[model samples]
Target chain A: MLLKAEKITKQFLRESRNTNQFCAVQETDFTLEAGSFAILTGRSGSGKSTFLHMLSGLMTPTSGRVLIQEKEIYSLSDKDLSAFRNQHIGVIPQGQSALYSLNVLENICLPYTLYHKNAHQEEALALMEQLEIAHLQAAYPSELSGGELRRMAIARAFLRKPELILADEPTSDLDDENTKIVFAFLQKAAREGAAVLAVTHETDVSQFADKVFCMKAGVLTEQNSL
Target chain B: MKLANSLPVRNLKGKPVRTAVLLLLTTLLTLTVFGGTLMIISLKTGLHSLESRLGADIMVVPYEATTKSNLETIVLQGATGYFYMDNEKYQKIASCEGIGQISAQFFLASASSGCCSLSVQIIGFDPDTDFTITPWIKKSYAQNLQKFDIVVGNDLNAFVGDTLTFYGVDCHVAAKLDKTGTSFDTAVFTNSETIKALIQSSVDKNMNEFKNINPDAVVSCVLINVAEGYTVEEVLNDINIHVKKVKAIQTKDMISGVSDSLSGIADIISLLIAVVWIAGIIILLLAFTMSVNERKKEFAVLRMLGASQRKLAAMVMQEALLVCLLGSLLGIGLGLLILLPFNQLIEELLNLPFLLPSAGQMLTDTIAAVLVSVLSGGIAVSASAFRISRMDTALILRGEN
Candidate 1:
């Protein structure tokens, strides 16, 4: 197994409500195997992004544990956990995720630079070429179009070549052609033995996913593989 | 990777206006601190040097000189003038009950004529009986002054071995005195014999203030030190009662006025420094807080990209440190350029003695000002850095909060 969640849940306090408590994600048990491409589909406010955040070690679960490769990630110290995430997990967050101050090339190499490590420029250039963003490497995020920014974020997520890739609504701003390019990239990474899990509302994602799941009202259920 | 390519430097380089404004704020902070401190120290040093240079406990001048305030102008305000009383009055002051030591001095003023380069005060002290000017002059010239040898003050244009002509009488400079930051710096000092010759030359040239008077029969002033177990006021009253045509004034009384003015100016500079310091810190705090708040999403993205909370906070502090370091150095450089070159003008404007501190002291003050400025900038941004580091990454990335 590449990633696993056992009875994980997230609750938020509702200050103005009489109940004074809200469950963003109910009890869920999930696992992702190596070399598998999984797609999570849900409506707005279905807690799909919340679940992906927990798996990426960004949001802490209110109950139970998150294990990646049989190691409980939340049990580690903040320093050790961040280092582990930097080396083994790659996340492509939703919306515009550029650091604004950095150009496209520096933003893509941030994961390596954050640890004061030397970045492999040739590999980063190859990824940019594959995403058709090689010509825009020297351009700042503000100068790029929405589709270009999304492609840049995807390129940055795959820079470290992590074993597991978690993407939250990664293709929400892409057109049909660019959406196909992004899905094909994720599918290719999965074929190369990286476990890829992505949350999206696009109907065409089923064609690329090996397994599919649907979430509703904070609950999750596995759907038959397409 | 080099630090020049780091995120903080890139951020500052990307927004030129914001970086410039922050740099200017810190520059104002350090300028006020360093300049104000140096001014206060110089004033205090000048006052202390003036006090020690006025070696007499009591001075007896001709009574008319006090009525015209001529002695005060010549001594305290750096003006040039001369007056004389009968030498018999000096003997009377010497025979007063509580006198420990007594010395008579002759004063003359050089004319701004073709023979002289500049008009200056010429003070002649009795070599055998003098106790005040000799000790100070000895620090520069050890040997006894020859008949026509002269000692020039620190601010005078004359140097050792140079000849200065007063009333057609040329006098050779023996040594230059150390700076006392007083009117004495502009005067020339010589023994009684050389000055009497100059005085006779003045009489011959029709420049003598006292017409038909013998130079050997009149002395300009008498300086006295009170005996042990006798207070300065007691001897001052004794001289006033016994002396016929002279005024007895305590040296301390002459200096009290200058001290009061110096104290008032020091207080105002200190208050100005406090006001600027407080205002700078408050403005910096507001600027950093607003900047960090507006960039919450950017930091949240870094968090999602595997940056720890510590790294996020350190990046913010590093940006502030870079601005403060550069700003403080610029401020200190500006302070030196303004304060040192125009010090003489400042002294004249305030009408008080002013001396700069030693070079080592100035170096220490420079370091202290830079450290204080950088530390205050750090303190101003600490709260904002801490708040941003603890922000909710998931909500910020989702645009939920």
Candidate 2:
């Protein structure tokens, strides 16, 4: 397995609420195998994004362990964990993830720059071409449309060619044609032996996944094989 | 990546207005610090120079000269004036008890000199028995001063080999003395013979204010050092009581007024520096905090993209470091441009002595000011950098903050 979660849970304190405690994600056991595409579907406030953040090593679980490549990721120091994430995992965050100061090309090459390595410009350009954003490489995020920005974030996520891809609402602002382009690219990456997990409410996303799951009221359940 | 293409540099370059504002704030901070420090140092230096150049414990002047405050005005305020007493009075002061060393001096004033349009004070000393002006003048001109050869003060507009005409007598400039940062820098120094000739020439041209006085039989004032076994008060009392027409004054009493004024000005400059420093740091703190708070999502995105917390903090500090380093250099440059060139004007305005420190001292001060400015900038941004580094990345990305 490329990724696994065992009895992961998240709780937040609510000072104004009577209970004074809120569980955003209940106990959950999950695993993602290599070379497979998975889809997580849920309503608003269903804790889908929270779960993805935990898997991406961004949010710590209140209880339980997250294992990537059979090693507990949260047990590592912050420096080692960040380095591991940079080398093995790529995340497509929701809602305008571009750095704003950087143009589209530099944003796509940021993962390499962070580690002081030479950016793979050829790979970035190819990904941009595949997403139909090649012509906008020199444009800043503010100058791009919503659909273009979403496409740019997709291109950046795939720049490192990591083992696992976690995308949160990656296609929320995309049009029908651009959404088709993004799904096709993720499906292609999965075919090439990268485990891809994307959270989305789009009904058409199910067709591109090998397995589908649904979340409700902080509870997650496996639905069916696509 | 090269530093020019680094994320922090790119961020600052992307927002020109914000970068400019931060740069301007640091510039103001450094300007006040460097400029105020240099001014205080110069004032202190000038005061010390004045004290050393006075070089006498007791000065006996004609009583009428004290009544008119002519001696004080000429020595402390750089005003040009002359007073004379009979040679008999000088002999009486020399014969007084508790006197260790004594020298007689003659004074003359020129309405307009050869080198400039300003009136100049001409002081003549007896080289054979003098203990004050000769030792100081020898630092610049070691050769024995001839009858008409004069040594000009540093502030004079005359140079060595230049001839200055005063009261229809031509005097050759032998050398120019170093700056004393006192009224002495504006005077002309020559031997008693040359000054006597100038005095006689003034009387011949009807320029002498005191008519029917013989130039050869009169002296301007007597400078005295107290004998080692006696106090200055004893010598001053002996001279004042024994002399018929002269008043004895202590040099320290004359300089006390100047010292008090210098102390007051130093305190004010120090207070101004403290206020500007405190206000600058506070304003910088607020600026950094607000800027970090406004960019929560951007930093959150970097965190999600695998930037370590340390990296985030370092980037913020790097921006501040760049601004402070550049701003401090600019401020020091501005300080030198304004302070050094207009130092004379500043001295005149404050009516105090002003001298710049040596080149090495100035260099050390420059380095210290830059380090202080940059360190203060670091301190100002440290809190904001820490807060941003430990922020909740998930919530920030979710737009909850």
Q: Best by TM-score, which number?
A: 2
Question: DockQ for each of the predicted structures, in order?
Answer: 0.72, 0.74
i-RMS for every candidate (Å) is 1.0, 0.9
TM-score of candidate 2 against the unseen true structure:
0.96
Q: Cα lDDT of model 2 overall?
A: 0.89
Off by over 4 Å in 2: B67-70
Each prediction's number of clashing residue pairs: 0, 0
Q: Which residue pairs in candidate 1 have backbone atoms (N, alpha carbon, C) closer than 3 angstroms, thus clashing?
A: none
In DockQ, how does model 2 score against the reference complex? Answer: 0.74
Q: Model 1 residue A77 lDDT?
A: 82
Candidate 2 CAPRI category: medium
Docking class of 1: medium
Q: What would the per-residue lDDT of candidate 2 be over residues B157-229, giving only the tens digit for each residue?
A: 9999999999878899999999977888899999999999999989888898977678899999899998889
Clashing pairs in 2: none
lDDT of 1 by residue, A69-120 (tens): 8989999887878888888898999999998888999899988988888877
- Deviation (Å) of B96 in candidate 1: 3.7
